[model samples]
Target chain A: MAVEKFLVEASHIMMFARSVGDANQIYYDADYAKTTEPGTIIAPPTFAQSSAQFDPDYFLRPKIGEPWFGSGKEPTGIKRESSGGGGGGGGGLHAEQHFEYHRHLHPGDVLSATVKPGKTWEKESKRAGKLVFSESITEYRDQHGELVITARGVGVRTERPVDSK
Target chain B: MALKASNLRVGDTHSVCIVEDLKRTQIVQYAGSSGDYNPLHTDEIFTVKVAGYPSVFAHGMLTMGMTGRMLTDYVGDGRLTKYGVRFTNQVWPGDTLQATTTVEEVADGIVKLKVETTNQNGVSVLSGYAEARVD
Candidate 1:
């Protein structure tokens, strides 16, 4: 996903930290952060993935007038084109993710992300059937045009929903 | 508070109970913050009737994110240079997770770490590696 502007703010970082159950004061309390090495509230290691919030066309999020895939009145807001695949209904699942941080993120940092398709491959698995994996690489650049983080993500569509063991 | 290369060893390991009794609400919180509102992670009806899962599950990134906390808490804030993970199994509600990091190497002011997170059932949910700067 290409995000022209991902605004990093303190409150969002705080909530992101809380979601992962991280209670480190350095993520929320600026005063306490001053006593730390970074000298300010810094985003968590995986916080770069939150750039989805700034991507206006991210499909996972429902738009104002669009038909979403999630449940509503009829167990789903949209009609299923086909229900032949395994568990996630071929909705795709996160397979792997890697991040290279040139620098940590902090409040007031405005970043932009550019995505480049990486590779596509297929694999067979006992628990999930045929797995189709595709990768994408995103480069996050700060307002000053310095590359901040390099992220590689792999998404897979299984032949069937993976068996929860 | 960064890790000192002088005190690190190849076999040194640190582990933390990342989450206890994982809750659906926390999953929702992650979806809201990360903007990954995939139905399989939040909507139980869609997940069960449509997606064909037993119930909603946690996002893989959520597990990675939580596991990341264990790394930062051990290596200290803003010290990470690289962190990555592969989702091995789905994380579900009520599953307590433990994340562990083992020092694989220390050299030239950098420490390489092997990371893994497992559910209470002793099944690995995520596994990967990380590298960080050291004193």
Candidate 2:
């Protein structure tokens, strides 16, 4: 797991919400949100985790040579070193997500996230046989050094991705 | 209506969010905003030909976030203690999604909910739950 920090802002919060096609005004309208108990715009659930792009070293960063969603039919030419046996290469898919809110997040909250490895399990799957799953938990705290939210996500990796064709 | 923990009861239902229809560009927008460059969600050529899927699909997070609108809308900002989702199916373009929640438990000023989001076809795409302290 990788640890990185970020300063949450109203604009970023609004963008993430809008990007998801969310119509909640509290996420975008500070004036409207001010009328609410929170008194300021707040991020929607999993906003910090979904905004991992702001943190470069995020644990869930796509592997260097792994297959990306937008790539061609050809396999990525990147090679994983043979030194690793148990841990496979960089290709994996997001399997599940969890978020625990310790407190509300508002604009101007300087959040720092520490991504840690969580539970690992193996199961037989009809789609991908003997699938391996790993969890990554990212904890976000505010500027006052208080926990705001803990985001737990799962990634499933297959030795070779399934062929839909 | 904001639901207080005291008011929670099993079978209490909350109508949350309705994604009238999904748009391909919306998925692209989400990927751009979230900084996820996964082509499987947006690259039709890559997804259909390279990945062997019938078509590109929505990002799981995109669906999760949309489903989360139910909790956030009901409880408002910062009231939710925990929320999570399990991806169950592919959400394709032209699909309509509705997120709904049911009160499963209530005690100690904490409310537990059984959350579900399904497409127009009545097929569940995401399922999970949440816990929030009601005031």
Against the true structure, whose TM-score is highest? Answer: 1
**lDDT, candidate 2, B43-101, per-residue tens:** 77655655556677787889888888777777656678999888877688888998889
Docking class of 1: high
User: Model 1 clash tally?
Assistant: 4
Score each candidate by Cα lDDT. Answer: 0.93, 0.74
Worst lDDT run of 10 residues, candidate 2 chain A, spans A80-89
State the lDDT at A95 in candidate 1: 93
TM-score of candidate 1's A chain against the true A chain: 0.96
Scored against the true structure, residue B119 in model 2 reaches a CA lDDT of 89
For model 1 the interface RMSD, in Å, equals 1.1
lDDT of 1 by residue, A61-118 (tens): 8899888888888888887877555675435899999999999999999999999999
Could you say which candidate leads in lDDT?
1
Q: Residue A32's C-alpha lDDT in candidate 1?
A: 100
lDDT of 1: 0.93
